[model samples]
Target chain A: MIAALRARNPIKPGKLRLGIGDDCAILRPNAGDELAITTDFSLENVHFRRDWHSPEAIGHRCLARGLSDLAAVGAKPMAAFLSLALPKELTARHRGKPAWVERFFDGLLALAAKMNVPLAGGDTAESPAHKGKAGLVAADIVLVGGVKRGRALLRSGAKPGDLLYVTGPGLGGAGAELLALERNPSRFTALKVAAPGHPHLYPEPRIAAGLRLRKRGLATAAIDLSDGLSTDLHHLCGESGLAAEIDATVVPIHPMAQLAEAAGWARSALQLALHGGEDYELLFTARPQTKIPRELDGVAIHAIGRMSKMRNGKPAVTLLEEGKAVSELRARGWEHFRGSSSD
Target chain B: MIAALRARNPIKPGKLRLGIGDDCAILRPNAGDELAITTDFSLENVHFRRDWHSPEAIGHRCLARGLSDLAAVGAKPMAAFLSLALPKELTARHRGKPAWVERFFDGLLALAAKMNVPLAGGDTAESPAHKGKAGLVAADIVLVGGVKRGRALLRSGAKPGDLLYVTGPGLGGAGAELLALERNPSRFTALKVAAPGHPHLYPEPRIAAGLRLRKRGLATAAIDLSDGLSTDLHHLCGESGLAAEIDATVVPIHPMAQLAEAAGWARSALQLALHGGEDYELLFTARPQTKIPRELDGVAIHAIGRMSKMRNGKPAVTLLEEGKAVSELRARGWEHFRGSSSD
Candidate 1:
């Protein structure tokens, strides 16, 4: 994770100086206001499992998870610190020693290195006495970002009439997640697995997307779709004291993910796409008619929802079906109380 | 950990401003340079175990482990996040009701609140998929501390003539660690099992002392002894390109610790004191005669060594029995690869 993270680190400017891979990652607070900070942990059982993903893939996704949260608030990641726990069984399971850790780093650190993000201080210790019986390992990744004073994006920033748009294909992560869960996933078409896993394993955090949204004065309110579209949208609506209108067909699910062949599984896919967590793509609200580009780096731009008044004025999510109002839907996103690892 | 951490947080004015508890901790740059940021994780097993610590105590110490590192470089903690993986067993064993988490918060959040530190964001999950296996818990604390345009503490800053002084008692943690490992630890000295539960349960991080050293412009080079005296001192010396001399008799040990009674154990205690890791006290070098208080807070302030030319230095540590040198010395602090978790 460290080496991969180090590999893509950008050449920091003189003022944005840092030393990665040290006792503590060191940097100068050259800014006038205080710095923005956030942390997120991805565990093996709760977040990801080795049986379903590679170490590098896990490393990359976890860092992206942290950074996406930072970007949700319009902060630019400056450094990442990774604290990892390894079961004693890792060495026995993976024959070669450093190679496993190295490959894991290859996926994990590569994302940070690209952004010149320093991999700072962290501790590594033996796994809990559980010995991966839960069939997973765990890691926590933290991103320290900087933003202009009081200019962070807030979920409450969304207002009535704001258009909800996403930067990339919205449902890719959900598709990939389902594929990951399947017994014979590779039997599925390559395209279905590619996009979601592309972002799922090694999410390209919309660091630049956030900056551009803020810079172009487009985003009024923003959030990363980490906890699936349903929960996040509800979260934004809850904070803004508003309701929402999501057009189901416009959510931009992966074109090749033949989830619909499983009959209502397509709806589950939509639900997962809407409610499946770990899509680091940006789900932000802008002016009702912001002229979003036709595409960004070939990823499709999506306009699947709109902020609205609460019915009789209550905050809720209303899905559109055949030009008629749907029941006030409970967002089927990952809920801490739900107790399910998958949405 | 959050409560205790909050309790010790120092308030600062301006854009370094943001509340601690949030989806993501917010920071606006101060205005001058970029922000210096870092995150660190402390995990159970890798960091601590429930068998040895009270929830409140564990909370405070786990978080403090990272804070001390920040203090070494004069960084103010901005926000902290916690990712707890509680096994059904340990959680229930510790009155696993959610209120226990609150108790954990009582000390943790208090510490953060004390410092005006906030709990920005974090996640909680079931422990490594088992009921009886040891649980996994992690705290990822991100520090957004200010440093002058070109100033921050570095281990490499010591000059040739710098004197090395450590705050608080040195070998006390080692003494405590011994108690924690014994099958019949209760049979140990009363001083050992007193309020603090020996060095095992709570190793007070020397944040204040390190910060004072930084603010007063005392130490030229500094590092917290998370690893042990031998390795940490060696790290400082190696970084500074200097040899060090630590007088054996001058090193402090906990008063009630009876580890010294056994034959090879006295030397072992000395070795533990020198290199026993996780003391989290500061090891720093200053001018040969730099004036510092006799004690920091209630902790002792002792001068045990000095930086010297490396030409003829045999072992970095020595025993002065009746002021005569003894040759049985070897570096025997905690080795991550070879050492057991005991020390």
Candidate 2:
């Protein structure tokens, strides 16, 4: 299996001194760089449904989760290690090939190639079955990235008077697409390849924007919108020990989300835009004096809010709605154990 | 839960620039050192049985599997990233504490501290259940270590005349203890703490000995005995393009295996010594003329075999029996999807 994976994704000689078939993969980072490591899990049902998701989508999203985290910190992805557990039937040779697993890697390695990261090392095992029932597939991805020492962006650097910005034109497309997937799964069966507009299936990690923000020293703090905007903004505020107020009128609603609302597939576009998760867009804060660009690396950027001092009675996040209405924005995002929702 | 984990394992101010609660953990490797990364999976029933092993034991063994890999390459332990999925019931608060998960971390963090590695970062989620049956627990550990540039002990560096050696006095203690646990599960319930005698419950990784070998330039090739001697030796030889020959009489059988054989619990101690796995011992090769020490870092070492030139018709590995009869040694170690066994 390791040989098969290696053959499919040939290792390009550079930072990785040793690839697979060893005790450990050896990486030689550039001289003054610190390594950033993150791990994320993609479990069946918790993160995706086998019935609703194609194997390609499942594999793409698994690697995307880790890459997004790396991008949030403005790190260049160096290597990725995937640990996968599949049911026995999924691994059984069909026509002398394990097609499902191969397609899964096809999706994963595609993203790795685009992002210039190597699939360095991994471990594979059969997911355990019980009482004759098939086991759920689970994959854990560990991403190793490199950033110049002391320059990597962090969530706790936001200060009062910092302007809040997000990459891309909008949010909530992933959630809207997921709703569509749950309602009519067959509509997306043809969506096998990864491209733009399939937000839920292949949400692009904002690596370029993050790198621009860090390289130009424009952002004071940064985080990826994995959980919904409300929850993740709350995380940024909590980490920075500050409060935030975002104008609802300025918050860009994804076109798909707007279409979902018009089609009666979702309740409200604004609600979905604020609370939907898996956007994979970068949410960052910049000094008010910094001349933030309208678009970064071809992705539209919008200033939607500002950081504020934490008052004794004020909520962590406040939403300024239209007609001068204001309300506390609770973090209704995908939090594990709190609800049956995927993050 | 992340906060609780951070509280318990407070980050020491050192190489880790950022720990948990961030997008990614940041590690600043010492100048000129290369990074070694490895990942391992611990799935329910496949790696550990809930009834046979305690949560602490499961956790310890999980980290040990990854640490042993780092040990094989003679890398100094730096940090560990763990991604865990647990059944909801196991994560539910009981008596104001999530006891099972906490105990699992207790076991994991204790080993990390002992080996001077940190609980760097991880992801946690509720394992998905199906048909109302509790979902299996799965934990994947990724260990990142550092070794002097160009000095990592790899499996491909051995020559035909190099001598093969193994750490510790014996092999198969873990496999023997596993047999005992399967026959009488309750007899091992009292084994709560990690000690030398309980090889299966808390197998110690040969990190020290590996470091000694690398720093002193002793070993030409190395691998950990996670899979049994026969299988791991096959891997080493395949990588180095060499064959091996060993004396079956000199193969060190663990005292526990001998006891199990005497008690009729095992068919033969020799079989367990040769093919049983999870010993976490280092199997390495040194130059034939080198004055190799009998003990490395206080652990006894045994010279078991020598690498030989590969012959077209000869088996990859050969065993010389008690009466000087020669026979082929097949790799009967645990392989995923090949059999219903654990590695």
Task: Report how far residue B160 has shifted in candidate 1, in Å.
Answer: 1.5
* Residue pairs in collision within model 2: none
Instruction: Compose the digit string of candidate 2's lDDT tens values, residues B125-171.
Output: 88877777888899999999999999999999999899999999699
Best by lDDT: 2
**Candidate 1: residue A316 Cα off by (Å):** 1.2
Candidate 2 segments exceeding 4 Å error = A93-98, A322-325, A335-343, B93-98, B322-325, B334-343
**A197-309 in candidate 1: lDDT tens per residue?**
46555566777777667666778888887777887787788778888888777777754233532544445556666666667778888877778775654556678778887
Error of 1 at A19 (Å): 2.5
* TM-scores of the candidates in the order shown: 0.84, 0.97
User: How far out, in Å, is residue A243 in model 1?
Assistant: 1.9
- TM-score for candidate 1, residues paired by index: 0.84
| lDDT score, candidate 2, position A202 | 93
lDDT per residue, candidate 1, B1-343, as tens digits?
3333334443356443544433465655434433345555556555544454556666776566667777677655555556665654444434445454555665675566556555554565565544445455555554555545555677888887787788775564644464444444344323211245345545666666766777778888887777777767777776677777677888876542445535334455555576566677788888876897888757678877677666764665444554567652454556432222211
Q: Which candidate wins on TM-score?
A: 2
lDDT of 2 at B142: 93
